[model samples]
Target: MERFIETLMYRSRWLLAPIYLGLSLAVLALGIMFFRELFHLIVEIPTIAEANMVLMVLSLIDLAMVGGLLVMVMMSGYENFVSQLDIAEDEEKLNWLGKMDSSSLKAKIAASIVAISSIHLLKVFMGVKNYDDMQLMWYVLIHMTFVASAFAMGYLDKITKH
Candidate 1:
């Protein structure tokens, strides 16, 4: 019975496989949204005000960053937690694939979050008139929190490695 239970427990890791697969759907949805935004930007290019054009481009960049984040999480999370991917040796592959452990993946994710937040904050500031002062303050504070958290995580990782 003990041996059987151990086998069951180990196999339970497979449960996460479906969850990781679901992230692909999220990536697909994000891609659709990105193209939709791009279409809108292209269509409005003729009459878009300079500021609004900048804002729209920023929005597209933000969406792209989010899409990248999702893909990184989905691929790295699966690689770390589930079975290794079986890829052909001759095929073009990501340089970091199969190399990122959970710790590095976490750091990368935190850094990506900070970058996304920065872009978002810039977008908010670009259209400052649309937001109340209090709302703008909160946005900056929240972005600062993300920055601090990422820094602390990197520091901890460095110290732990030593």
Candidate 2:
């Protein structure tokens, strides 16, 4: 009975499989939104200011970073918690697949967040005339928080490795 219970407990990890699959749908949705924005940018190119165009580009970049983060977390989290993914040798494969452990995944996530925050802060700065000083200060503070968190996480990871 004890052995059976342990086996059942281990198999329960499969419950997360559906959640990871759901992230794939999210990736698809983001892809659609990205292309939609791209089309809009193209159509408004002549009418949009250069700064506005830059801001749009930054927004797209932010989306891409977030999409990447979601994919990484979904794939790595599933593999680490559920089961190994078997792929044929001849098939195309991701170099980092099966390589990122939970710690690495956390670091990657933190780094991605910092990158997204940096892009957002840049956009805010670019549109400084549209925002009050307090708002701009808050944006900078938020970005700094992300930067500090990433740095601390990296430091902790390094210490743990040693």
Best prediction by TM-score: 1
State the weakest 10-residue window (summed lDDT) of model 2.
118-127
Q: List lDDT for all candidates, in order.
A: 0.91, 0.93
Candidate 1 runs further than 4 Å off:
none
In the range 32-69, model 1's lDDT, one tens digit per residue, is 99899999999999999999999888889888888888
Can you give the TM-score per candidate against the true fold? 0.96, 0.95
Worst 10 residues of 1 by lDDT: 78-87
Please give the distance, in angstroms, between residue 131's alpha carbon in candidate 1 and its true position after superposition: 1.6
Q: Which clashing pairs does model 2 show?
A: none
Candidate 2 lDDT by residue in tens digits, 1-162:
999999999999999999999999999999999999999999999999999999999989988988999999898998899988898999998999999999999999999999999898889889889999899889988889999999999999999899
**Among all candidates shown, the one with the greatest lDDT:** 2
- CA RMSD per model (angstroms): 0.9, 1.1
